[model samples]
Target chain A: MSEGSQGLLLAGVGGQGVILASMIVADALMRAGHDVKQSEVHGMAQRGGSVFSHIRWGERVDSPLVPLGSAEVLAAFEWAEAVRWVEYVRDGGAVVADVRTIVPPGACNDHRSWLRRYPGIDGELFDSRHLKTRLIDATATAEELGNVRAANSVILGTVAAFIDIDNKHWEAAIAHLVPKGTEEINLAAFRIGRDVAEARVPQTAPDPEGFSGPHQIEINHVWCKGCDICSRVCPEYCLAVDVDGKLTIIDAEACTGCKLCEALCPDFAIEISAPREPAVVGNQAAADGSTL
Target chain B: MTDVKTYLREWAMPHVLCPGCAHGIVLRSFLNAVDQLQIDQDKLAMVAGIGCSSRLVGYVDFCTLHGTHGRAPAFATGLKLARPDLKVVVVTGDGDALAIGGNHLIHAARRNIDITVLLLNNSIYGMTGGQAAPTTPEGALASTTPAGNTEPNFDACKLLMGAGASFVARVLAANPMDMTKVMADGLDHPGFSFIEVISDCPEYFGRYNKVGGGAEMLTWMSVRDEGVAGPLAEKRFVNHIPIESVPSGMETGVLQREIRPVYAGVRKVEDHES
Candidate 1:
């Protein structure tokens, strides 16, 4: 590592202005009489994918990439991204993160439980790393300033507090880089963000009630005409008709309570009963809880 | 959520519909909509005329009235006017609503009364031994039209929309969730809500047309969906039915919704001003 060089990382969802914020940081660093190099990945920006940028500044900056556990600070625009990029920050470094959550498409695999695969706001996770964490609702602050799009400026303002750069440099870069006519709100958002307090971290949400286990599938043999409709419509392939023209439960435990078979059955012979216990206990809990 | 079975008359289990019939699915979706709306069973009324679709009213635990053939809409209109507090729903088959009771159905829609009409169009009179119904696609084989009927089929949703129905929608039995959603919207509508459910009769229509069983019929119905309704210029399948007479694609979703004064009863002089 260089004697006087410092690295910073910014992480967020694709459309959260991660690249623009990185550019502003680099510009401000240059204005502070330091050589700066910045690199970013926004290939999946339009698809709501992860976006991140690395900025390094010093007397003579070389590599724009911030090595693992070497960054001085980490700025994250979303909650999940904060946890994702927190490892890059060195011990005792600072983390500026917005408490906003943006759930990706892949996390919506289990529609039956209706529980999002998202991490809760837990400060203990950062405490384990011995890092300073500042969680703020930048979007709400920017929204109060009249435009929600100025949220990135608010985040940049908090990030500015951690860097040893002058306020004039940040305001100049923000005013010069942001879209025309949005300068006032963005500057106001930055000013408010500089003095913003730590937001109240909400407690971990409890598992939703009523969905305890696999739904109970009951079939009335007398009413079921073995028409093959219910068996074919079952997404989980839980029901199947035998050669003798009788409905049977082939995979009872796989039922997700989608109710497709129950709703499509022609004879009203199938009924799905909700599970009596909570499905969130033990091994069946969402993977996000244990991974974080 | 309350069990949908609670809304049904358990003794009426094993409905009289033929094997592989889609009416049962429509019934289940309707019950789901009713359950979602949380309408009190005692305060809801199910009116039906004589047909396979009409038989659905008899199985529900709500206040039901099985009227004469093709007169379900007339009965529903009277019941709604007499008891404005009750949520009245008329379940009728294509043959019952579009043919036998077509006049009453059109008049009820024209008047914009507060009632929901679910016209289950199976394209044949399944209860009457597979006779050709008014909604039977041209060139389709029915017991009465073995030589392929020369008469054209009726687009039930278009007819209702043209008759000034405040809310009009068409849903396929293949998509039960979408069917339930549209049914819920119709039930919540204020005046003259008409929903045409494209159901299948595996024993009758499917067998006569060689359209396979219930599963195949459902797939075929799904393929006919012309996407959600939009502006007339943006519609891909503008013509109701293609010239090939094979029952071309049709728009499925809320086709029209208008806020019109509902016909409650004889309006007073001051009522017109309001």
Candidate 2:
């Protein structure tokens, strides 16, 4: 996966639809012929605490979680929380923050007033662009859309246009997730955000399918134990052991495409293969028991 | 004896649980019920609390969740609320249910949400090395109750029945035959069904009580109440052992009542204004 296609993070205080926004991005990625993994912290969010969701996608994804400092873009629904999760973004990554600061339970009697004077949060720690932040009046946009509930969806639209994901995939995902009767307001919110994001970064290019990122696994053969334990642990059983118990990957085609073997290999002797479009069944084997 | 191997998740190893523990029996009965019902395997959510009995989900397939101690009821409650169409089952031991999760269980029954709660009762706590539990017999010896347990045990069936559970019953794990029926009935019944399995904790309860072994314990349980030993017995029996052999309706277990409060205590607020 390309650094741009590892996907984005969505963060906010409670009640904001950070989870829903992440889901929307995941669905869009899926529709664009990429594998996507989305994870959210559920039970704790209702108590008025910061909420964040990790959205990771690629031609292939090994885990739902994104390691910190890998997010290509961040859609921060709250100012303070934006600062809190800014570390998720990579250096030079973009942040589309909603300027409306929500008062966490004990901030002050006049949190709204304090927020107006709440000097901007720094973004350099994650190597992200500080001055390039897009301040969106998402609440105001939702109000104009006739319902404040559509704010997250509006923010997602802006995120879509800023990232490489296709706008149609985002729209399709909205259609799939939203309840039967609430399509119009959601689509409207999506359009508002998409337009905002597009307006901010006019030169950004849309991400194409099968984009490869710089992250790659390197093998050190000198450290190899040759115990063949990695072959025994492979879930896809992609490993083959010879009479001497030396390990070798057999029919890498049989690999369910999970890197568990590589990750768990005792001797860091297994390396990641070059980026190639994952093969569909037709070319690999015949329909019946016979090999192609 | 239902084979648990077929229903268990392929990767789940039988590494946990104690020997002669009734948790295995309850878990087997639950898997049998799911199999018989032809439930959508993917949609079945099994939530568990902390205890020897609660660890049973590690051996089951489907979406198994191991939550905090005594919080399976609350966690299952939230899961059921979020996805009403899914079949949600909460499995917890006596300590997990009666001690820490008592409020959540009672409120869950009061609400009568469409969920099943299988409460495994082994007289004493087995996970933390057999301390005196709420369901421990008054004279039972435990690690914490060196002399003997002074307090009375809580009849969980009575509590749930009083709280308006649509279905409530109790069965013993020694009687695998009856356990299958009881568990099946609990899973099929709508609203909140509370089924308490009088499970065994041989390493703890047996050694403390000097009950030779699980077989001896089963024999003792079988012979305790022979007065109700009749055809189509008016009382519940496990493995033909009348564990709770008192007359129906007069007993604490085997209760079926009308629905009351449901999920998260969120009644149909006339408007969405709450």
Candidate 3:
């Protein structure tokens, strides 16, 4: 850790132009007459996996990896990724995160409750870390400027406000790195980001009613022909056929109320009933209503 | 969100279709479409000809007519013409509509009558103990063709499209949601709506062709679909059956839709004077 040396962290999901944004940042830093080194991990980026890059700049830079709790700022392209990499920023460091959520495929494993494993957009979490948080709807701003793909440039513009670099270097780097025809749009998006106001973060939504318990799966044995359609289509594997070719509920507690079995059952033998009582187990925040 | 069971004749529970037969799913999807459209159950006429698919009309609590083999279209056309307010739907099988009642089916389409024909093609004559039918793919084994039929199968969608059906579409039992969507679209179409549901006869077609059970048969159908890929398309269901036995590149979803004049029959004297 040398004096005047600062690290910047960028985290986002795949296909969000995380690598391209990092290259633009490093290029801007180079144009600002600083020693800049950038490294990124994007092996699983094409499959909608997590992508991150570490950028460090100073009079003399040794490593591109930004050690934990040493970054001056963290730019997250998605809500979940913001919460994931917020710890990397030092105390009182800035965090610029877009209020966009991309629910991953792995978060859908809990088929019993149908509750996503994503966190809510609560600024209190960052407040507890004693860090300066700047939430912005960069995607919306970029979309309003006529192209949603310029969202990363908008975020880079916001990051410029925190760094001591002049706007001319960022403009030059954006013009040099952006696609052949999108340079104008990217430049306009950057100016909007540089002067953008803090977006209003909404409160966490209340949990949906009548989702406290697993749904009840009723099977009419008389109508069921032991076809194996319901059991096979059940995402939770809640139903099965016995040795005597009779439908049976092997795991009633795992029913997610998805009703795929009930929908695809040929005999009308399967019926999914919601829990009889609307007991409030706990407050689970719903997904944010923000959109790009 | 009325329960589809409300439209069913509870006494007819446990339908006579064979185990793993997809006709039950088709019936449920149809009831869903009817419920979505909010059609009056009494004003809805379901006509069926003698076949495993035709038996679906007997289970529904509607103005149902069990007609002679391959004559469901004729019955539906007559019913629609007499009671123009009623929503007439004909449930027929591949053999009943394509083989035995081919003329009536084509004539109904040619007239551009306001009747929805849901031709459930299981690719075999399931009601007659798995005999070869007109829609049965070539080289597929059936009771009548133990050495594999040396004939080409009929593409039901193409046949209906060529017959001047204003609305032509195909769906599969494997994808019930899309089936419901296309079924609803067909019911809403004004004239000659023909939807061919690629249902599965696991007891007959699956066992004879070694395509596994109802679940495997659905996976096979989904794999062979050339329409927009769905969630089931990505699943690796470990199919061991030979590739050539099952038909491939069969496109699903709505194939054609057009606006045309509907055959409303002879108008009354008061209607002409007005």
Candidate 4:
């Protein structure tokens, strides 16, 4: 009930694990001895639709709702969703948003060519003078790391770093809350997010192409969702993900040009080019596409 | 794990269902039935309304869809009529099917449309913080009914049969094998098949009424005898019809399997009789 209590809002499209991530955060906060109150909305129009969770924590909390313009944190799962709900962030509050953009189907319902008329989303929507922002390409990062679904965990990690909670409690909550077999990956994502926040570094995974061989695979950085399936399934052990979570070819020659990476990519970002003469490493000049 | 993984959308695992919610059990049982039946995933259409149980459609990797709250039957009816080739199945929770959807439920059965409806009856409105629902046991405690639910609750299986469904069965979440068997029977039935999954809502209903958590409720359900649908079981459930008229001996496994003409895509006898 205190005026200076902590309040956070988690917003994302449905099937994005909004409720689960919020629950994990609530658990961590409650274990840290803070009174936590959480409210959520679940229903029929959820699949691919907008969803949100409201969490409040402090010495003593009253209502679960954070009231307009009073939240300390606005953790969003997509870039556009951050813009849609950035109004709730209190002055000086931080917005931790995933850089992915998901345009609702209704927005483009009428016209197949609406993008030409409307152009694209503004990348600087959350860059207001008053509000602090930490945007992460969590989907790409998690996917590139082997699981695009870990974006929620990665975002939670990033959010946890900005908050005052200790690492021990967060770990405990994640271990208890996350389903079996995903603890390590989620924990790694949490740590990566924490490191990004603590270091205040812009995420840029060093060029994925480390070593070159007779066969070359170029990954369009913009299009990759960063689910690490390619790296995990790669027989060559030549692929490695960078800190930025954009996939990079760590060992090029090690790749047998198996085309497995290209086959497994959900985003179709990997292109296996038959042994190029000059193996161009990092700094993808032709990398700008829809993948980002 | 392999068996379920084939049916489940694994990415959506550790579903939104609460810790002790029995909806998960019923969901697994249904999927097991699908696996046992060797159903072609592409030829199957899964429809659901709003509730915890309805969300099961999301996890099933099939031609699954979600309709508006309490309108799944109508949507399923439309799907069945238009694309009779698809094996249409409807999943709904207590509030969704019985309260707002009571109209569609009766009509779907009356028409004998070929659709399998798995009504997960958790007594209270589990999604809406446990308000009293049409299927909540009379005198049962709920958040809305502080003093206890005063109104009677309808037995969905009986009501579906009374509405002229060709196949009807009542099973519990605690008994997965029986639930799966009955579910398979319902699915294989030519006409409208209705299976009532007596579910548990430990968070809202149990916490309010002091019954117990999900495990305890499952234990209670497990010990109860099946196939003994005599006056004792009849007394527990509420029906609009008289007790004398209500059939005793609801033989549990598959209560009804009558050979009736299906309504959908069926020609009238008078039109073809020579």
Candidates 2 and 4 compared: the better one by DockQ is 2
What lDDT score is found at residue A255 in candidate 2? 47
TM-scores of the candidates in the order shown: 0.76, 0.43, 0.78, 0.44
Q: Write down the worst ten-residue block by lDDT for model 3 chain B.
A: B265-274
lDDT of 4 by residue, A150-176 (tens): 889989988886679888999999999
> What local distance difference test score does each model get?
0.84, 0.67, 0.85, 0.73
What is the per-residue lDDT of model 4 for residues B180-227, given as tens digits with 9 covering 90 to 100? 788988888777888988778878876886656654455334334334
lDDT of 3 by residue, B15-99 (tens): 8988878888889998998899999999899999999999998899999999999999999888888888888999999999999
Q: Which candidate would rank higher by TM-score, 1 or 4?
A: 1
CAPRI level of candidate 4: incorrect
Order of candidate numbers by TM-score, starting with the best:
3, 1, 4, 2
Docking class of 1: acceptable
Off by over 4 Å in 4: A1-292, B223-251, B266-274
Clashing pairs in 3: A266-B25
TM-score of chain B of 3: 0.92
- Give me the TM-scores of chain B across the candidates: 0.90, 0.83, 0.92, 0.86
True contacts kept of 2: 0.00
Error of 1 at A25 (Å): 4.6
The C-alpha RMSD in Å for every predicted model, in order, reads 6.6, 24.5, 5.9, 24.4
The alpha-carbon lDDT assigned to residue A141 of candidate 2 equals: 89
Which candidate model has the greater TM-score, 1 or 2? 1
